[model samples]
Target: MTPWILLPRRVVSFRMPILRQAFALQALHELGRLAPDLARVRAQRSLEASLQSLREACLTTLGMELDTLTLFDARSVVRLFAHAEQARILAHLMDERARTLAEHGDYVGALSDTVYAGQLLACSRQRFGVQRDAGAAEALERELPKPGP
Candidate 1:
């Protein structure tokens, strides 16, 4: 599979599986940027495993178990229209994964996951007309470090 960074920015699709992969790639890219030397090497290995799970989710009909929940359900009734709820669930999973990464000293990966979680949440709201939750994306915005001087 092509590495996420090599994929063109405009190539990302609205499809749920594709979006999940794209976000995963983006988070991995950020991990490369922000993690320290030893941590970056360790995180690359860890995140690669996560990416493989995401790849399997994209390719298979069966759901993949992730952190106590299955993020993909190809048979769901809602998938007939759009994967809005799926996206929301994946966003929640991303947040949880971020915490896990942070606990393992992959803070850059955690930040990237949180930011993309917010993006995925916002995308779900806009695309499927899901009602906005007041507490959702705002905290992610707060977590983003301000621009450097």
Candidate 2:
């Protein structure tokens, strides 16, 4: 009788430009998550250049157009920010088709943006304070939703 042996499958690694873009996008998302308010407006504004920087980084690092590469589908991206109140402010800034306060020469949109930004800032500060007082890194973790088992 011949002995039979199972062989491990060969591991293949391939470079994916879209994955890189997705990672960069995730970094941007994290920035938004960590600093939802205008307290870091300057830092957030710098991210406005990130989209272009991402494209350039892709060309230089991966020889690809990161902007052209679709990482997260539209629905997924929308869902990701759906629960975030600060996203309304970001949406106004990011949406090219959306009307702007400047376009209408009205203060209402700008005022709303400012108000939302303040709310986000307050929420972040409160969370930080809670974590600091509780002396537990996991304190704020409970405030977040748990993933499905």
Candidate 3:
């Protein structure tokens, strides 16, 4: 687990980028579905880039001391929770995107996204508590292709 320290000054920094990436991913999904083959490829690449960025933002806030959050002012703690919520939303979005990718036969990319989203969901459970997203994660896990013997 990476050691995380959440300072008051650092609280507001991550929200915008993560939110922006989430929106971009949502937009790219629509474009990827409707665009020409070449344009679809470009949209997929851009979506991947946005997903990576969002993952990094979430990673930075994970592994923090939940007890230590009380040491900070209330505002910082609220911001931290908001950031975690944003991460949760993006993880679900990624899971949806992964399902689309799987339907289109991009199994490798689909698997990667599904696994990463599961990790994010697990981290959310750890950082907070039993989240409502557990069932969704289980559904995604079941959707993964079974390995060949």
Judging by lDDT against the true structure, name the best candidate: 3
Would you list the clashing residue pairs of candidate 2? none
lDDT tens readout by residue for model 3, 1-149 = 23355554366576777765465344334323322332334346665654444343333333334224324543344345433453454454456557656656789978977876666656666654564345434433443333335
For 1-149, candidate 2 gives per-residue lDDT tens digits of 22322222121123344454354345334433433232233234443443453344334422334344234333333333322322222332323111233234446644654554344334433443544323322322332233334
Best by TM-score: 1
Q: Which residue pairs in model 1 clash with each other?
A: none
Candidate 1 lDDT score relative to the true structure: 0.48
Compute the lDDT for candidate 3.
0.48
Which of candidates 2 and 3 is the stronger one according to TM-score? 3
How close to the true structure is residue 88 of candidate 2, measured as C-alpha lDDT? 28
TM-score preference between candidates 1 and 2, better one: 1
Candidate 1: 10-residue stretch with minimal lDDT? 72-81
Best-first order by lDDT: 3, 1, 2
How many backbone clashes does every candidate have?
0, 0, 0
Clashing pairs in 3: none
Residue 20 deviation, candidate 2, in Å?
A: 17
Q: What ranges in model 3 sit over 4 Å off?
A: 1-84, 131-149
